[model samples]
Target: MDILSLAKSVGSRVEAPLTDLRTVTKVLGNPHMPLLLALSKGFVEPVYRAAFLASAASSGVLHALAVRPCDLESLAERLRIADEDRPRLKEWLDMGIRLGDLTKREGCYKLRSLPAKALAQPGNDAIAAALEEVLRFHVPALLNAPRMLREGRRFSLDDQDGLVIARSTRVVQPLVEEAIARTLDRDAPVRLLEVGCGSGAYVRYAAELNPRLSALAVDLQQDVADSAAANMAEWGLTDRVETRQADLRTLDAQPQFDLVTLHNNIYYFPEAERVDALRRAHDLLAPGGRLLLTTSCKGGNIGLEALNLWFTYADFGGPLPQADELVDQLRQAGFDDVEATRIVPGEQFHAFTGTSKRVAYA
Candidate 1:
């Protein structure tokens, strides 16, 4: 059948019997080729570049390149690429050079882009891990949402690396640190209960902020809790802080903590149970204790939006919370003097603080 006849029969996205490639390619040129290519350069190139950056970061290429220039053979050896794969590895590095992220001179490759260098530096590991998260989880969700939903396939904990998540969530550390500082008593002896304490960084910050502060950092994952415990020991905080593998929901509500914190893990609970979760945290607090929470709320950049999309198709977690809704949840959970503040400029990231009213929920 001719093309026009086929279009009439099959409708807009024409699907019919197998046809000749020449029949389609020969008929017409894309009249908007110039605009199309412009948009392609603007949009398409970034996706490829992002994928490249994420891969490079995850594979330690960006860090190695940022440290020093390497000949192709040297880079291959440094990355431990097999002899058979060295040629393809070289080709990939050549693409990085083409993307303007790497420079080659005198048979040596080095980081060329400011982003590549910055992402390779210390304290920016979270940003690099965030890139990895986008590549592994967000991109897959975006590309396969329809098929996944149709097949009833859902994202589960097994699909994601918790260690990478622990690293990536540190992208919001500065905001969370500020919140902790504002809530923590500077000179008083304060007992803290931290939920989902990734890396034990905040506990460290809190300890630094107040010499008399002691903490019990809890995480749902045993390995994470153990790692945090090791870090606490390394930081000379073993005498002050303790790390435990426990869920806040079922944790023994000792009600001895002067302050309680839940950072970046609210979406771990279903929306219906968030209030109850907060109440549980509240129950862990002593009288007149303060509760501080920080999270990337719904509606931000593409990454944050993609993160929300991730949980929408997740079997084990809920979507990112709305700022207003979370505040309401905090209040409903029997927290008094509730206040919410936007921590990151021009982003939906927020910090919420409330005081314990000492109400026990059934």
Candidate 2:
């Protein structure tokens, strides 16, 4: 039957069964199939594009293309795809060409689209990392949430690739640097304790802002802490900054730091424990020392929501803070003059500054 006859039959629950592939094929060939496909492509293409680009980025395909045009074998070899997988690699690159992120001339592939070129640039590495984060973490957090909930399985910290997160967090470097500038006493000697010091980038930024600043950068994970330490050494801040692998809660209440900062990691602590965590940070600060905490809070876009979703389901962390609630948390943690500012315009990212109100907790 033709499209109309088949549809009318299906609509009437008549002769044709909806499950028949033959009938479906006739309907797919109908006059309106182009419009149907156009609508479908609008939703499907972006997903496919993101997945392809993210893979290309993480697998060094973007770099391979940017460095030089490469034929299938050469590119596959550069990407270290096994000889047996070369055909699949070729197919993938061909799809990229069709997607407009890559082009082929003669027998070689080159970066074609502006985004591919831009992401390949050294300066735009943070943006590329952010794209990887979206594909790697955010998408799965949302798409698999239902199954995860049903299975009672959550994304543990180890489930995430810390290196990806550390790199991706730099996407918010500008906002974070502003918060640092607001809190740091640039000319004065300052001692800093940075919690969850992902790549030690912020610590480097702060050290640059204050010539007399020395810092102890700490992360809960050994690998992350080691990575930060390596970055600090490479940045030539080894003499000024010390990197440690330690959880904030285990640290002694030193009360020596002039500033304590936590950026983009508040949700790593459960809401029940945040006050205590903040209190630990509070105790680490000297009298008059300021705590600079920055985080992506509630009421943000899908990206932030996905982040919150991960933390919510994780065994160790909690939901993104609501602004007033976090303000109260800092207060409960014994911080005086707590103030929060929207550091990123039209976004839920915030910078909070508060002074230590008392000596280390008894």
Candidate 3:
């Protein structure tokens, strides 16, 4: 199938136009890729990491010496470990230093900016703890991908409904948060539309943060749409956000929103379908309205070897556009000032913004 070529093709077209991830028209949603997303980041790993780190701290005296600017000798002395344990501790120190969670100058270690603050705060060793536990989970899922394919069995991380959860953490949450922070005026109302809203996580976060903001969450799955509805109600945002099960290809009834969002959900369709969906989103925008898109290309953090190959074996039916190609498509679709930014440094996900061409009402 020339899997690599196929994956590369799919990754290219899935970026900008097919940003709405609600539809799964092909083998792109194979359980492997998304499973990696879930384990790498989520409440699932964070909660477990917290517990593991807490236990490691109590028994291992290194916690006391992990403070900023602490020397290796001092750290070793604080641990007071048996000679055999030194190698393990050195390896741990080496990993932490590399991940940017810790800094090493000369022979001393210091916390990185974010973790430094978390560590300084009272009763907050959360960062270190979470990192420890999540690593354990990530390793197993990564190694088991080949086994699942060979055995013709589902991966353990696959959702019961057979969807592979995002292999990446809701890492985009922070990006959206930053966007909201910059665009929102204090105490001013905002309206957001998530075109391929899944489970309402983004909407929920938006509603919770900006009491004055309203949201429209749309997904293709009736069950997921219902779940988002229930969540809005549970979160007391029923009056603020509405959930709907509508296909993006046929969505034509909604009012233009202040902002439209498409998370890392594209790539299930062929080239033509992707472009058509993008045109629809472009047409739906009001004057000065912005559309935000998120997608991963071949250059993204998680390797999509399986996904990249699926395009060839599955019959693309159309050619997929890469990052530059998608941007050009957005411009051609009549969107103005199309721009893209890397939401996470060295990560696959990217954020793009385009404004509808403002037409004068004569």
- Cα lDDT of all candidates, in order? 0.86, 0.88, 0.59
* TM-score list, all predictions: 0.84, 0.88, 0.52
lDDT (Cα, tens digit) per residue for candidate 2, span 110-216: 99999888887878778788888888878888889999999999888888888889989898899999989988999999999999999999999999999999999
Global Cα RMSD, each model: 7.4, 6.0, 18.2
Clashing pairs in 1: none
Worst-scoring 10-residue span by lDDT in model 1: 5-14
Local accuracy of candidate 1 as per-residue lDDT tens digits, 1-362 = 75433433333223555376555443334455445455556776698788888888888888887788889898888788899999999899999998889889999999999988888786689999998888888989999999998999999878887778888899888889988887889989999999999899999999999999999999998878888899999999999998989998899757899999999999988898899999999888988899999999988888889999988888877999988888899999999999999876787888999999975456
Better candidate by lDDT, 1 or 2: 2
Ranked by lDDT from best down, the candidates are 2, 1, 3
Q: Write candidate 3's Cα lDDT for 1-362 as tens digits.
A: 45433444455567567654664335367656455445444544454444434334433433544444676566667678576787777777666554455567777776664644354443543333334324443344455656756766442212212111321224345765665554443476767878767657777776767788887788776776777688778878888887898777787555467777777555545666676777777777767777777666554433343333333222322222367777877787777998867666775555667888866475
Model 2: lDDT equals 0.88
Give residue 288's lDDT in candidate 2 (0 to 100): 82
Provide the clashing-pair count of each candidate structure: 0, 0, 16
